[model samples]
Structures are given as C-alpha cells and as structure tokens.
Target: MATSNRPNAPELDSACVAAYDHAVRQGVFDDSDVAEQLALGEAEVLRIRTVLTDLRLLIRGEDGSATVPASPEIAEAELSAHLEAGIIERREQLARIHRQMRSLAPVYRAHRHLPQASQSVRLVEDPAAVRRELAAATRACTSEAFTVQPGGGRSPEALNEAIARDTTMLKRGVTMRILYQHTVRANLATRTYTRKVTELGAEVRTAEEIYERLIIFDRSLAFVPQERVGGRPPGAAIVTDETIVGHLWRMHDKMWQSASPYDPRDVDYASTSEEIKASILRLMATGLKDDVIARKLGMATRTCRRYMAGIMDELGATSRFQAGVRATSLGMVKPDPNP
Candidate 1:
C-alpha cells in the first residue's frame, strides 16, 4: 500500500489505538467484529480505521479492507521517521521566518531613535502603547524590578497575568520587590500569589498606605501614572532621566524599609489594624470624609465607617470631630495644623 503523504494527519487517540490493539491480538482485521467487541458505533469504527491508516499502523489489502496490523517495530520506525521529517520542516520554516524578520531589525532600531522615543521623559497617553512599552522594558530588565501597587487586592485575572510576567523575570534571575497596601494581607488570592512568588525568591511587603503606583526597572527606567484628573483618560509617564530615576529608586527603597514583610501565616493583623486606624485618624484630623479615607487606605467606605465607629467607641467620643480631638489629646494622631 502507498504511504500517506499527509504529514499533519490526525493523531491516534486511546479508543482508536485500543481498536488497533484488538485487531492485532485477533490476528485478523474485522471491523464489524472489532466494533461488536469494543462496543463502538459503525462511524466510530470507520474513524478508527481512517486514523490507523493515516498513521501507517494498519496494512490494507488491494480491496481497501484493513487486513493486517503493521508490526510494532516497523510501525514505530515509520512513525518516528515521519515525525522527525515534520520537525525538520517546521524548523526550516521558522528559520526562514526569523531571517525575514531579522532583515527589518535595523529599520526598527532607526525608528527607535525618534524624538519621543529618545526623550528623557515621555507622556504615554495611549493605554495600548503604555502596555507595549512596559512589556518591552520588562523584557530588557536585567538586575531588579520594584513595584508599588496601591490597592487592597488585584483581580484574579490581573494577578494571573502578573504572575506569568513575574515568573519569567524571576526565572531570568531578576530581583523583584513588590509593595502593596496592607489590605492585601486579608485577600486570599493575593496571598496565594505572594506565596508563589516568594518561593521563587521575590520579596513582597505591605504598608498602611502607598503614595502611588510605580514600577522601576534596574534603577534606570521608571513608569508612573499621570496625576489623575477628572474627565481625562489614564496615562503613564516613562522616566529615563538618570537623576529622576535615581530619586524614584531611593524613594522606593525608603518605602520598602518602612513596609512590613508579607507572610500569609505570620501577618501581625493587630499591628496592621492599628496602623490603618492611625492613618484613618490622621486623615480624619485633616477633615477628610469616610469615602476619601477609604480611597486612600484601599477599603470600602462602609468598612471605613465601621472602623471609624470602633475608633470613636475606643476614644469615648460621640462625633468624628470629637474623635479626632480626643485622638490628638491621647497622642494617637498629630493635630492637622491647616485645619
């Protein structure tokens, strides 16, 4: 019989391979008998035969009937040769594509020297462009990456994406240090992500509050969101100036020193809760509302109100104003001079 030329033939699944085995054991190929013994439908039996034939595991007679199963040694050698040939063809195809793309590398480099790209500070307003630049910067990062994420917990999808990106960097031996709001310690998904990355030698910590979201790569390049304004789309600033990047790096290091190490099992919730309450009292003393305080501390307004009620009860104060005054007297919070 002529060999099949279909290099991309369908693979033989378990059911089809089982049917082939039954035929080999019977010393004769009989589709109807095989179907009866295997409890397979006629269509399924036909499919098995087709796959076997395409895989060159079944020998067919001139009448196009499956007559004998190929010997194991002969079948393995034929399949191995076919697979190796396919692999070689794929490698050659990939090489050709790589060569074609390689020819355009110089053109890309030339365009990279455009004013905006070479600027020390670039305002990237397009979200997609920001993501592309971030990915490029991440790939180029060699020594270390530090990031501050100022929310309670990231969504699972976002964490999954971050884990994949960070895993690649960790595998490349990049030192990673991430800081998050202390609220993340209460999040199961965030804790799981922290555990996985910490196992890979990354450090994670949490603070009562973080100023803003920032990502610095190798103390050279930094990405920061633009100062938020109502009615404007979000944008990021890419900083490449040595002095500014150095200052940002030092700020991050200072924050890192102040943050507590994140251990899911060993978290000092009491200490963390006290710190959060103190932050809330400080904000309250400045005449901030509950929602504003919640926004700053990465908690819901309802939760923030509940915390405020508890604080008032502890301070024996009836109103937020009285609570702030009493807290100041107790030296729990400093007086807001401007207020």
Candidate 2:
C-alpha cells in the first residue's frame, strides 16, 4: 500500500472501526480472527482490510497472515487526521442547513400560530396538564397498556398514586406492562408497588437502558415527552396519529419481550447492579453521553457520573472512551439478546 496520505481516502465504516479497535487492543489479528470477532462477511472483511491498510493501520503480509501492526497511538493520530478532513466537509453542509432553517423560520412560526384543535397532536405543558392527559389516556385504555418509566425509584407518594391508577386499570381487564431499569429492583417502595401490580395481573420487567418515558394505550393512543421550548416549562405530547401511535406501541412491545421478568427475590440482588453496569459499559462503548445513559437507567445524572468515574478508576483508564474500549475487549457485557 502507498504511504501517501490522500484526501480522497474513504471514511472508515463500522466494520473498519471494529477491526481497527480490535487491532489496537490485540496488536494484530489475521483474516479469520477479524471475521470471527466482528461477525463480518467476506465482502465486509475485504472492505475493512482496504480501509485499515489505507489508514496505515495494518501492513499486509506476503502470505496474507501475521500482518505487521501499527501502534495505537500512531493509528489514533492518523485517525484524527482523517476525521478532521471529514469534519471540514460536514461543517460546510451544516452551515448551509442552518441558513435554510433561518429562511424557513417564518413558515414554522405561522404553523405554530394555528389553532390547537387543527393538529392531530396534543401538546400538554405543566405538570397538571401532563397528569390529566395521562390519566385520561389510562382510563380510556380498553385492552392493554404499556409504559416505559426510566428513573431510579418512585417516592412513596408517587408509587401510591401510580398504584391507585394502575390497579384500577388492571382490574378493568387492561393488561398492564411496565419497563423499568434494574436499579428499581433494589428500591423497596418500587418493588412493593411492582409486586402488587404483578399480582393484580400486571406484567413488569426491567432492562439496562430505556429510551424514553412513554405510555401506549390499547395500541391507539400514545404519550411522549415534547422537547421543551427555550426556558419554557417541560411538557409532553398526546399522539393520536395512527402511524406514530403504532410505532410507539411496537417499540414498547419489542422492549417488553427483551426485558427480564421482574422477580420478587431480586430485591437486594447484587446481580442487578452488574446488569446495570453491563448496560453502562455497552452504552459507553457506543459513545452515548452520560445524561442520555442516566435517563435510560432512570438514575440521576450525578449518580451516573459518579458510577462511571468509579468504573474508569477500577479499569485504570485514562479517559471514558478508553474505559469503554477496555470493557468491550474484556467482554464485560454481552449484547442484550432482544435489543
């Protein structure tokens, strides 16, 4: 391969990234190792080989075995150079998009001024409005209700309130399913409520990370958070659109099947934290921001950050990404079977 640094070199694809990351850790890996480790096909391996070679990350051997390796430090420097070139190109595109947004601002404003009844979506601001919307949706649920509640644990008052609503819904023959983080398994109040609902015909499960807070009613109505306007109070959306509501319901259905069944004995379970750690490792490996991970685990941002610091310290990592990479190489976590 030419040693020239060419501007036209292709950007690294996901396979190439995996191979590169593997190489950085293992120092070298032959064709079979790369294929087996990354689960890549022949064509993908070929592409990854070409990209790694062009980036000066791997040196081909005459026998197609025992390729010479590049030090990770040097490879990372080269990676930075390649990324800088790509960023320069993308920045121009972003600037043009921003200009277009400026041009369309007035049109957006005009639509915003339209009467609320005209839109199929209902935007509820303020805590009371959100609660009312949710209550109304739950009451109207005829067949099933699925909810993803991402947060550590509910307060006694909050759990009582939720139990009252959920118990009624369950008794009315509405099948209730809720998704929670493993952390909630340790919360006494939450577990108590979880047990009560499960006995009342509600199915509860937990996952490592949840996407967002949502409630889907009878596969017809769905409620989701609305992005808050600048300095405005937080709010949510009551989605009535068939396409959107169906999508949300399907999402909940998939996550429901993936999550572990809520076990009563799991209260004070040490393995639950391990599961949460594995999820954090997986999410960290993919470069999710801390706040995003916190929301998924239903934990406070501060708590999440502290937990990561502890993990990184234990791993002797110099940075968060390095901690993630080390954890990945160690197989500290397996991919969630359903996700």
Candidate 3:
C-alpha cells in the first residue's frame, strides 16, 4: 500500500494496537486474520491498515499473511515532517497577508495626514469624508480616545458597530471616556452600548445635557459637529491645531467633572421618568411649550406631553400655570431668575 498525507487519520482501536504490538514483538504479522483476532469488522481492519500504512508503521508485504513488523521511528519521523510542512505553509500565508496590509498602510497614512488635514481646522461637509477622517484618526490613535454622544439613543446596528470598533481600541490599551445624555437611561440600545464599553475599562457618564457630538483622538486632534443649517447636510470640523484641541479638551473636562456615572444596573425607568418630568416642570415653568421642551430634550412631543400630564395630575392642577405654582409649592420646581 502507499502512504497518505492526512495528519489526523482514522483512529486504530486500543485492542487492535495491542495486537499489533504483540505482532511487532514477534517481528511479523498476518493482517488477514486481524478482524477475527480483534473481534472487529472488515471495515475496522481496513481503517487500521490504512492508518498504519500512512504512518509508515507497517513495512512492505505483497501478501496479507506476510506483512512485516511495525516501525515506530519511521512513523514519528513521518508525522514530524508533516507537522513541519503545515507550520511552514501557515507562516507563508501570514507573510503574504502582512505584505498586503503593509501596502495599504502608506495610502491610509497619506490620507490621514493630508495637507488639508494638517490645517488648524478643516470644515468637512461630506458625510463620507467625515467618516473617513474619523476612521483614520481612530486607527491612528494610540494612547486615548474620548467621545460625547449627545443625542438620547442610538440604533442597534450603530451600537454594534461602536462595540466592535471600541473593543479593538480597548484591546490595544487605549483609554476611552464616553459621555451621554441622562435620557440614555431610558434607551436600551444606548445602555447596551455603554455597558459593553464600560466592561472594557472605558469610563461612561450621563448628564442631563451634553454638548454636540465630539470625538477626540489622543490629545492631538478633535472632531465636532458643524451644524446642519437650512437644507445643507450635516458635517464635522476636524480640528488639528493645538490651541483648539486644548480649548475643546478643557470643555470636555468640565463636563466630565459634572456628569453622573452611568450605572448599568440602574434600569429604573420610573425614577428616570420622574426626574425627566421634574426637568420638564422647570422648563414649563419657564413658559416653554410641549413641542419646545420635547425638542430641547431630544424626545417626542407626545412622550413629553405624557410626562407633563402625569406631573399635572400629581399636582392636581387644571392648568399649566397652576401646575407650575403647585410644583413650586411641592419643591419640585424652585423659582430662579434664569427660569
């Protein structure tokens, strides 16, 4: 028979191997009676024969009754040779992938540090360009990254994408700080996203209010939103100048100092809703309508009205003005020159 290339060939039964060992000690073996001696089927006998041949354990013999003894040294050498070949093959494949990746590194770096990107502040209006710049900066970031997601909630897909990106950064030992609006406490997707990042040693906090979206890579550069006015599409400002980065970092530090910790276990919707209603009460006392308050808090008007109705009912007030007075009496709303 001929040798085979399989590294994990069909297993030989223990009793059959013992029988082979006995035969090897006798310096010869009769393979024809192997099934009868081992109480195995013809298929099992054939499998053992094939594995022995592939391992170079069975020496040559034309007739089954004249088979030669096993050779352990030759079998070990053959297996070692096969393992060596597999290792070499894997190393070569990795080398090829590394070369391909290296080819793209220069291009990515060139775009990441373009002349326009080198400017004090770049006004990038295209969404695709904004994403490209962000991806480039994130890839280049070494020590740390910080982000502020001001809107209340994120889509499940967006949360998954963030988890994948931030997980890689965390694995590379990058420190991350993320700030969210207190409204995120009511958002399942946002909570899931923050919980995952927090588990990776990223600091997460929530505030009643946070500035517009910001992403800072290390202490070198920052990205902040360029408002969408009229009918123009929204964009971001890529700030590379040191002076601007310092200004932005200081603003972030101040907010982080004031933001509350995002405790994943605190999924108390009722308490969060009451707090939101109290905020609405204060805002309503200031004469902001339902729509304005809803817009200010990044929630729907109907939902805001529901909270307001609950507040009004609790105060036993028939009108907004009465509700304001009753809330003030209940210490839910304090009078202020700003309010």
Candidate 4:
C-alpha cells in the first residue's frame, strides 16, 4: 500500500500506528475488526499494515491471526520523524515572515520621521497658530475631510473662518462632513452657520453628547484640543497621530450615522427637550440626583431640575420619584431614534 503525499499524512500514519499497537495489546480484535473500529477502508488499513510491518510490531500468521512483535523502536522512530518534519516546516514559515519584515524596516523608519509620527506630536499654543496649522493641513489634504464640534459652540470669528473655508472647498468639489451635538439646533448662531455650510453641500448631523472638537484632513492629519476650548489655557492644540486620527474619524462616523439632520432655524427644540426629558428619566431610574444628571448631560443643575419638573408634569406625577416610576411604567425611555 502507498502512503499519502499530504502534509499531515506522516503524522496521521504515526497516530494510526499507536492505535494499532493499543488494539493488538487489548487482544480483543482482529486486523479487520481494528480497521472497522478505526473507520479506515481496506486501502488505508493496508497502508497501516505496511507501517506496522516495517516496525516489526505485527506478524501475519498462516491461520490469518495477527500477533505483536517484541519491539516498539519502529513506532517511536516514525513518530519522531513526523514531528521533526512539522517543526522544520514551521521554522521555515517564520523565517519567511522575518525576511519580509526586514525588507520593510527602512520604510517604517522613514515614516517615523514624518509629521504624522506618533512619538513627536507637536502642540500649537496660539489660536492663530492652530488656525495656521489647520489651514496648512487643509491645503495638504488630497482626500476627504471630517470634523466634529460638540455644543456647536464655535466662536463667531472661528465659525466664520470655517464657513468660508468649507464654502471654498465645496465649490472645488472636496468632500467634507461635520457633526454637532443636538443642542446646536437650539443655538441660533450654530444653526445659521450649519445652514450656510449645508447650502454649500457639506454634510452635517447631530448627536446628544459630543465631547471634543476633532478635525481630520485626508484621513492623514488631525487636530484635537489639548485643553478644553473654554479652559484657562486660552488656546492649546494636539496634532494627532495616524492611529488617533483614524480612531477619531471612526467615532465621528458612528455618531454621524446616529445623528439627526441639521435643519438650522427649523429645528424643533420641543423634540430636543423631549430627548432631555427621556435622558433625565433614565438617570432618575438609576437613582441619580438632579445635579449629577445635569453634569452628565452637560446642562445647568437648575435646567436639569426644570426638565425633571416638566417630565413630572408630562407624566402626571406629583414628585420626582413618582415621575421615574411613571416613566418606566409607560416605557418612555425605550430605544430612541438614531438622533
């Protein structure tokens, strides 16, 4: 009988030899019975017989009974050979991978020197400097741009500058997208700004919790605030690495997908209020106080309490605890629309 040429065939043959040895020692089965038990057809059984014969572990008698030979050296040698071949093949594969990595070392080293390198991130300290850097990044962009501004709270001057740049880019057919927090709909200035950008064909969406401002140009360069925009440092910037930029872009997309359309002056604050109410109800159900809920929702504590009062009125509750129970009973906090 011939052996298979498959990669694992030798190892498989060795295992078959071990099983044959066990069956022979058990003395409860003939070779044909062993073949049936092992689920191998006659051809495979013959191959095993040949291996066992080479090992001298089995002797064929004229009466058609099979007897075990004295030695186990042959089986041990077959197993060793199979294992050695597998190890050699694995080592060769690893060597190939190492050689490929070695060939890429120079390119990797060069990339580390580029502005996008991870370790040498620069900080832009002045607003003018930050704007200059962003403008430079815009000029360098060869692909699409993405941005996120939570609270839609850009300064009037900055907003005007961004609108002008976005308008110019839109006329030139560059792709741009921006995301804002749902609160933007209620901010007249932000609504007007978004309307102008939307007229130029840029995409805009809104979410409830937009944490930081992010701008990614061509999926390559990104700018994020190092200090909160209103923080005491005045103006501080952190130029992003490729990995962080990519992550920001992904997060922007996820929020954008969940945001409602930015309809400027036409936005319904009533719906926004309802969303706030629902969020308050969720927090209340968790036993959170108005102050804590206010911070989490990025609103004033008084405003949060006012919203809770409104929720109670809507649910016909006489107290805060009653409002929570009623909200749950009516399932008012069920999954909301993407916005």
| Total backbone clashes of candidate 2, pairs 3 or more residues apart or in separate chains | 2
Off by over 4 Å in 4: 1-120, 229-237, 265-267, 289-292, 295-302, 335-339
Q: Which stretches of candidate 3 lie over 4 Å from their true place?
A: 1-30, 52-140, 225-235, 325-331, 334-339
Q: Estimate each model's TM-score.
A: 0.72, 0.57, 0.74, 0.57
lDDT of 4 by residue, 1-339 (tens): 233354432333665666566666775335677676777778877777666665546655557655554345765676568667767877888899989987997886566453533343656567777777677677666668888876435667668887877777777777888887665566666777888877877888777666677888787677776655565434444555777767877877877887777667575588877776777788888788878777666667887788888778888999888887888888876543333
lDDT of 2 by residue, 1-339 (tens): 223455666687777778888876786757788899888888878878887787777875567667756765787787687677767777887898989987997886467533563345767667677888788777878998988887788789878878889999999999888888788888889989998899888888888767688888888888788665675646887778899889888867787887888876555677777777777778788788999988777888897888898889988998989998899889885775545
Clashes of each: 0, 2, 0, 0
lDDT of 4 at 186: 66
Lowest summed lDDT across 10 adjacent residues in model 1 is found at 1-10
**Candidate 1 lDDT, 174-197, residue by residue in tens:** 999999998888788898899989
Model 2 residue pairs with clashes:
151-298, 152-298
lDDT of 4: 0.70
